[model samples]
Target: MTQHLTIVDHPLVQHKLTIMRDKTTSTAGFRRLLREISLLLAYEVTRELEMTTTTIETPMQTMEAPTLEGKKLALISILRAGNGLMDGILEMIPGARVGFVGMYRDPETLQPVQYYCKVPNELDARMTIVVDPMLATGNSSVAAIDLLKKQGARNLRFLCLLATPEGVARMLEAHPDVPIVTAALDAGLDDHGYILPGLGDAGDRMFGTK
Candidate 1:
């Protein structure tokens, strides 16, 4: 099956992305925009969530209404920058279970090394969504998915604010089962593995500490 990669080009998301991309945007503004755009993207990502009917009583009469079905969704944030997106998604789906994965690159091997991992209970039963602001080289994202798979999370999706073609290709090649939901796919990656014409270091910009 072809891995689904959705590039949400919603006007609100695009407008906020542009504002966040401006070098002069303040840290506060960046954080706010990230949250706003994340919410918009989250709405798109969860559009296909399964729903069931539930009886509800209205003033006029009782009727069945649509409600989320099965297990509650899980949101796993690939730490630091991912946390920024996580916060906004949480606002939209407050009941979603939360998980964290921390990966750092090894200078010698240029590979991801997981330093931390903690996921919610019964991951296999839930639809897990991994949130990260930027998909640069896809090393950390791949590593994070590896860890999740090891933890028994079979149904998984990755959500990001920005993605590079290289990163999308890498993720597809590495893990074809996982779908990627992103706000925008920029041109490509730079020599240093940074997304071209992309907002600079997400974590640094969100935290105001380049």
Candidate 2:
């Protein structure tokens, strides 16, 4: 992956995002919308995956079939909120290898602190995609990607529902080679490190937490 940022401007993605931003939307509704939007985002994120052809015997005759090249894709969820996006993408690419990087912000410092991590072997051989709902400070996202790279992940991409300018800049500065795919890039972040006009705390909204 190269330094890139793709904003998913599809009507369906935007519509669902609008609903998710509504404060009145129920937890169930928010979760449902997230799943639907993620599938749309997944479509764009994997659009350039390499393909190879192989001969296959069809019902009518023999033909060459185009299939994905390289190792099975590795999907890394940044934990908690990331699970929402991960589940949807998994529905579309069920064959992908799954992993998790558990991290949380230190309320005082707003820095990411790793709590857990589990990933597949041979990360250097697969296309790894990291999923998260919001990219506010980008500290956690960057930290997650750093960890993945340490584990040998090379071709990596970052996917999220919303992002702020600060977060995007931070990611670019830290890992320019990793591409970013988001549904919307909001105006900026609030004082509390939340994306302005964002759908509040993604985890709280999706899980009905206060």
Candidate 3:
């Protein structure tokens, strides 16, 4: 991708995001909105996927059918919150291979600490998309992408619901080749590195936790 970042400003995406940001929105409602937004984001993220034609015999005649080229897509969810985005996208692309990178941020330093990782094989051949709901400090997202690259993931993309300027800059500096697709780019991050105007903690909101 030529551009390093893409903001999906679709009307529906923005409307749903507004609801998700409301503090009064219930957990079930938040999760439902997330899934719906995910589909819209996935549509943009996969827009440029290579296509190939294959011969197929129809009931009346023979024709060439257009199909996706290259290996099956690999989706790497950045643990708990990423699952919300991944779950929705998976429903749209059920054939995609799924993976997870588990990590947590240290409250003291706000750095990412990885605890677990399980990914698909032949990473070099697949189009890998890493999903996360929010990109605040960018520490965890960068770390996750670094780990994936070490595992041979070459063609990669990052998808999220919201992002801050600091996070986007950090990601570009670290992994410029990987394009970023987000629903909205907020003003900036708060003192504790949380995204300002963000929908609170994505994991907590999605799972009904603290």
Model 2 alpha-carbon drift over 4 Å, by segment = 1-3
* TM-scores of the models, in the order given: 0.96, 0.97, 0.97
Prediction 3 TM-score vs. true = 0.97
Better of 1 and 3 by lDDT: 3
Worst 10 residues of 3 by lDDT: 1-10
Q: Candidate 2, residues 1-210: lDDT per residue as tens digits? A: 224789999999998999899999999999999999999999988987889999999999999999999999999999899999999999999999999999999878889999999999999999999999999999999999999999999999999999988999999999999999999999998778989988899999999998
Q: What is the Å distance of residue 5 in model 1 from its true position?
A: 1.0
Which segments of candidate 1 are over 4 A away from where they belong?
A: 1-3, 107-109
Q: What is the C-alpha RMSD of each candidate to the true structure, in Å?
A: 1.7, 1.6, 1.3
Best candidate (score: lDDT): 3
What is the model-wide C-alpha lDDT for candidate 2?
0.93
Which scores better on lDDT, 1 or 2? 2
TM-score-sorted candidate list, best first: 3, 2, 1
